[model samples]
Target: MIRTESLTKRFGPVVAVDSVSLHVREGDRYGFLGPNGSGKTTLVRMLLGLVYPTSGTIEVMGRRMPARAAEVLPEVGSLIEGPAAYPYLSGRRNLSLIDAIGSRDKRSARRARIENVLGQVGLAGVDERPVKAYSLGMRQRLGLAAALLREPRLLILDEPTNGLDPQGIREIRDLLTELNKAGTTVFLSSHLLSEVEQLCTRVGVVDRGKLVLEEELTALRAPTGRILVESPDADKITGILNGRLVSRAGEHIVVEHEDAAELNAWLVGEGMRIASITPERRSLEEVVLAATGPGADRLDR
Candidate 1:
């Protein structure tokens, strides 16, 4: 439902996004991961027509972006940077205004839509409260409700879990899962690796103004092993596993060996009785850090 080809963006002499290409299919819960200043938000802005790209193309929902963005944007709902709402207005009123401006549905239809979305976001009872009185989590929920007001085909959320408590984060995560199950395509951008690990099926990692990696979360999380052995001769065991061992944490050893069974058999035959053995898997954070290279620290700039 979304595709980009060599999308580039620049500011003065610096490039924010360079030849970045990506694609997302229907019903995809796609995660866009990057460090700060990694151009994630800039790419999202271009997709939404808030910023024009310096070169290349963006196609969203079968329509070319920037060129046909006016026709395509109405089918997309986005929460960029953060939720922007009228502080003095009630939550319901804010949504009502959005519906009036963004949708052509009748007043009664809009009201019904507003109520349904408010309930979906868990804000039904508090819709009448002024937005200024709402907590950060509440505002985030309210923003999501507004995004759903038009029943958009694509939802673009940038850091939707920012400032949310554990309960609120879980709530939003569950809501997004439900939406994707119902056939809504979700394009999520966030700095939280754990959240992406839990919520996304596929992910794209960006760094230093370039696209670094894009792959299924499962592929990125391929199982690896970490063995912790308690032996009378810990140093001796470490020497035997020299090249295969990745690191050491006190008496425990973390290794990245291809044949765990062979290693175990060798250890046992060598008179080492293992007290405990634990396997470790690569996490989303680890995969991202590896793919982006050591220069990924530019994301913090």
Candidate 2:
């Protein structure tokens, strides 16, 4: 539910965001990927109306942004860079205060809404300890709870799993997936390629302040005319497809096959006991690397 046309932003003599047209569908889990100094933060700020663009247009939820921010932003949730809260206040108290700001909801229902969002973000039954005592992960969870406070229709998150162990990351991943399935459009900007590979349905890669790639994850990762086969009859299968075989490593074999299904059927008919067979596809990492150059963070002598 977000669209931009030739969106550009400048700072004095430098351009932070170049001419970039971006599209995010209503129910998509979109991954916005870029390296440091690639202008991801600038682009996100423009979308949130925190920074006005130098040229072009932005639309969120089918309405012009910044101009219609009051009408559109209430339905949009965001976590940028990281979360913020009163360090001395309890998490619950922090949420209560944030929830009360410009909230049209009834006072009596605020507590329930707060608790529900807390539970959703894995902060359920949290003690009343001041936020200063919470670990980084807890603070991140607290921030997420704040974002979910309004049951937003669109979520724009940056580095959402910044300070957590693998389990916590997985928990948040599952939570985001569930929200997307329930019709919340997610715009995730992350440096973690694996996380986006697993979570997002579509991807947009930016480099040098320009949009480099934008496409469905499936299409970007299409099969590469090769099949990986694991089988008990590796030797026998190798002999049967000698002309097409690319390599053999113990029970695993790589074959130059256009269709895994056809190769699988041919092996099955040959009385080969196959363990597993699937077409090889480029990883999201491979695709993104091919599309963009070195990150701006790298310094060469």
TM-score winner among the candidates? 2
What RMSD does model 1 have? 3.2
Off by over 4 Å in 1: 225-251, 259-278, 293-301
What count of clashes does model 1 give?
A: 0
C-alpha TM-scores of all predictions? 0.86, 0.92
Question: Which parts of model 2 have CA positions greater than 4 angstroms off?
Answer: 231-243, 247-251, 268-273
- lDDT of each residue in 1-301, candidate 1, tens digit only: 9999999999999899999999998989999988777899999999999999999999999999889988998889889999999999999999888889856677899889989998998888884678999898889988999889878899999999887898888888999999999889999999888998999999999997788899888877765655545565567788887587787767677766655577677888998877666556788988888877555454563
Compute the lDDT of residue 69 as modeled in candidate 1. 81
Alpha carbon lDDT of each predicted model: 0.86, 0.94
Which candidate comes out best when scored by lDDT?
2
